[model samples]
Target chain A: MKRNIRLLIEYDGGRYRGWQKQGKNADADTIQGRLEQVLSRMTGEDVQLIGSGRTDAGVHALGQVANFHTDCGMSCGEIRDYLTRYLPADIGILKVSDAGERFHSRLNAAEKTYCYRIAVPGVPHVFDRKYLWHFPEPLDMKKMEQAADFLTGRHDFKGFSSIKRTKKSTVRELYAIDIEKKEKEILISFTGNGFLHNMVRILTGTLVEIGCGRKQPEDVLTVLQTKDRQDAGMTAPPQGLFLVSVKY
Target chain B: MKRNIRLLIEYDGGRYRGWQKQGKNADADTIQGRLEQVLSRMTGEDVQLIGSGRTDAGVHALGQVANFHTDCGMSCGEIRDYLTRYLPADIGILKVSDAGERFHSRLNAAEKTYCYRIAVPGVPHVFDRKYLWHFPEPLDMKKMEQAADFLTGRHDFKGFSSIKRTKKSTVRELYAIDIEKKEKEILISFTGNGFLHNMVRILTGTLVEIGCGRKQPEDVLTVLQTKDRQDAGMTAPPQGLFLVSVKY
Candidate 1:
């Protein structure tokens, strides 16, 4: 008998190539590759670990969901413990549970929340550099918030994606864009049904440009209407972006 | 004309040896050594930096103060900018100010505050591992608080000092001990006029031991009375400690 297992995962992705397994480097340092290796070793069989989404190199995850089917006679607790013991310290299996037979990590996902951090204008935070984008210049929160207003709701985000050609639909529903200013940092969180290859980063870049006065808030409308990738702002670096959670 | 200067410094101490400049390795990868190197190059003369206190290897700092005398012609703002540009990313000069002629970093100091972070029993925070001590065992806050009470006020902390022999006075005034629990993490903060070598780490270790039930609250008084190093608990790892601030 096979069991469909779902896992809530957390990882510091500084060393990972990405979330997916690559063909050339079958043993490449990747989140999925590492998970598959640990699972295969524990179960004595090959395991295909499917993730909710692909996070780019240097992108961290807090509640990344993954699913796998295994015929091995091991309890969820045992498998969780084995993975915890063998996996690298940067990666952790936060929770493990039985999933529905038809459940798929990506397909069954309802929404995802991602947060990007910006260091405010002040002394550099050396310790937080690995996880934050340090912008020395003061950013206008009003302009950034105005730009964020234009980013909410359904839209064809082809201009924001990195992929040049794709068969999948470019339309995605952005439920909310919350911009918060902490003591010396700014956190921008986005909740959406799904994101394009680099949609969230591009959106952040656009907002940042507006905040810095290089681009106006109304420019977001033009980028969305054109559906041309070049029309969008530069993609923000991956380090500052974090997959906050995935709702099912 | 030579001018007295004070520097507010911050550093991520994971890579550096410590805050002091080693005699053998004059160009050591230490915080003080690095600052002197940058200052020497900028001023075209040798520089000596005296810190408020020495932090052990792997110990971090947010506001570790230092003072020096320089005959350089550069303005304070220019010197601050030069240090910011030349110093390694891990080290930063938060502020540079002209100090009183008699101002000494270690002598005219008023008080200092240090914070130690302990990860409680829960899911590991992978990103914070570099700055927090991960203790998976459950700790009793009440026991730790009771132990901290005995640590306040002036006492001869000979048992807490790592140095076997010292010419300096072991008696120091501890103004306050603030223990805060945030989620699954415990933050232990100490405000004092001065601390002996490894004093904060040893105090934290003693409190942690008491929290885990290995020692009792009254054990603190016994340790102080004995003035024996072995009477105290283990010296906690340096990474979990931070020199939060120094007041003059």
Candidate 2:
């Protein structure tokens, strides 16, 4: 009997080429490609795994949800163990369960959260270089907070995404934007109905520029209104970004 | 004019040979070697860096102190910046200061603290793989605590050292052994007057064995008395070990 299996995954995406299996190196390097390979080996059949979203290269995830169809009779617990034992150390299966036959991870998702970590003043932790964006000197928290406020609503985010050919609407509803500073690190978190390609990173870059006094908080409104990617701040690097959670 | 300098160093030792620069690979890799190279180039003089002690390859440090003598007149802050700019991302100079001409990082140190991180049961964060030992099972905390209590105070730790030939006394005074669990990670902390070669790693391995029911709490005393390396548990890998602090 074929069954739909859902997996809650965690990964340090520094080594992968992102979530989707694309490009010439897709089959060997991407997260989905790796999962499919492991699942195919485990079940002795080809498996198609669908991710809720595509996280860019060097983006980490703590609660990425994926679903796959398999005819194998192995228990969910066994499958989780097998994946944990065989998968690379940078990827892990946090939870496994049986899903309804028609459950789609991407289509059923309601919201998503992404967090970006900034190491200010200096990089104090050598082990965290893969996970933090080191931004030297202090930032103007008030200005960044003010800029974040301007971004928390339904709007056309074409200026934020990198994709230009998509026929889909650029509108996305941002539920929340929380900026928290702890010690030398600042964590900017975003909750939204969905994100477009490079949207979160571009948003982070723009906010950081505001924090650094390169741009005023009100400039965000103009950037959004123009719907031009060139008018926005530079795209931030991917190492600091994390898919915090997915709501379905 | 020659000046005495003290440096507070932080390094992700995953790629280096060790703290001390030795063998034919010296000057190419190794924390000490890298630091010396940078200092030599900055000051235009050959430099010798004396660390608090030698750490094994792959052992990380947050506060490993070192001292060196230089003839350069650069300010401490400038020297710190020079080293920071020249050294690789994995090795960093956290603080630099003028020291007494006679001061030595190893000789003047009163105590040192080391920490070992163990990931238990489920691996939730893949980013922490390089800094944590993944032990995929429940550990008996009570047993580990009891074993740690036995290890506190003065004890001849010859059995714990990996050195096969050494005339130095292995009698070391351990100030405390603290075992704390933070979510899925268990931290094993040790404060001691000094430690022998591979002492901290060996001690951790034996404690973990006791925690997993492979050895009893009372066995620590017997291992110390025997003064035989073979009687103790396997030496734990260095990736999970950290030189947390060194007191002057």
Candidate 3:
């Protein structure tokens, strides 16, 4: 009998080559490979877990959802304990639960949220260096917010997506886009039906360009209208992006 | 003409061996080394910087202070700009000032504060994994506080000192010891005139042991009375410790 198990995992993507399996040597070690290894050991069988989405190398996630099928009758606590003990220190299983038979981590998700963090002018804080992008120049929050407003709502985001994106459709419904300024950090959060490959990064890059006065807020609409990748801003670094939550 | 310059330095202690010079690869690459490198580049001469104290390898600092004598007539802003342009991304100089000849980073300090962070049960947070010690067990705050109280005031913490410590006189004034629990993290702060080699780590080890019910709160007294290194608890890992501030 197969039982569906849902897991909320958190990981530092720095050590791995993104979330998927890759070629030999350094690339073979990834979040998915590690998960399968742990599952294989726990059930004495080969288990392949499906994740909600793939994150680029050096990208982090706080509430990434994954699901797997197993015949074990152990409680959710037991599964969580097993993974915690066997998994490397960088990856963790935050929660475990029995999922519905037809539930899918990726297909069943209603919305997703991501956050990009930038540390303003100062010594890069020793404690937070790993989790934030340090920028020495003082950014204009009001300008960034104005650009953010232009990105909200449903639109074809082909201009912001990577060229490698193979998805059939480039359209995504952006529910909200918020730009918040903390003491020394600027947090840009996005909630949307889905994101194209590197869409958030490109969006952040364009907004940052706007904040720095290199581009105007109205340029965002122009870039969207152009639907050309070269017209979009540079892609932000992966370290600054975080998968905050996946809503089911 | 020599000018006394004060620097607020920040570093990620992981890559470096420690804050002091060591022999070969085992030695610390050091925050001091990096600072001297930048200074030497600015002025075509060797530069030596004196820090408030040494933080062992893997230990981080937010307000670590350093002072150097330089012949360059550059103002604080100029020096800051030069370092910001030349320094590596991981290390930064937050502030720079011309200090009086009598000012010293180490000797003029009124108090030094250090924070030791411990992550409670559950998954290791990817963002804070490098900066905290993950402890899976539930800790007793009351017991830990009781043990912490015994450490306050002036005492010869010979038992807590590492065997490698060369300081003949071990008597030091401990102004305060505070234990704070926030969410799933425990922060233990220590303020003192000076700390022995591995003093804070060993003290934290004993406190944690007490919190875990392995040792009584009064056991700290017995450990201090014996003045024997073997009588104390294990030294906590270095990553969990941070040089929080240095008051002048």
Using DockQ, give the best candidate's number: 2
Error of 2 at A231 (Å): 1.4
Quote the B-chain TM-score, candidate 1: 0.97
| Residue B61 shift from truth in candidate 2, angstroms | 0.7
Task: Using DockQ as the measure, name the better of candidate 1 and candidate 2.
Answer: 2
lDDT of 2: 0.90
- For candidate 2, the share of real interface contacts preserved is 0.54
Output DockQ, candidate 2: 0.57
Clashing pairs in 2: none
lDDT of 2 at A28: 68
Q: Which ten residues in a row have the lowest lDDT in candidate 2 chain B?
A: B120-129
**Model 2 residue B196 lDDT?**
94
Arrange candidates by lDDT, highest first: which order?
Answer: 2, 1, 3
lDDT by residue for model 1 over A133-179, one digit each (tens)?
87667789999999899989999999988978889899999999999
lDDT of candidates 1 onward, in order:
0.90, 0.90, 0.85
Task: Score every model by TM-score.
Answer: 0.89, 0.93, 0.91
Q: How would you encode candidate 3's per-residue C-alpha lDDT over A115-166 as one tens digit per residue?
A: 9998876545555667787655677888888888888999999999885556
- Candidate 1 residue lDDT tens string, B197-237: 99999999999999999999999999899999898998999
How many collisions per candidate? 0, 0, 0
Rank all candidate structures by their TM-score, best first, as comma-separated numbers. Answer: 2, 3, 1
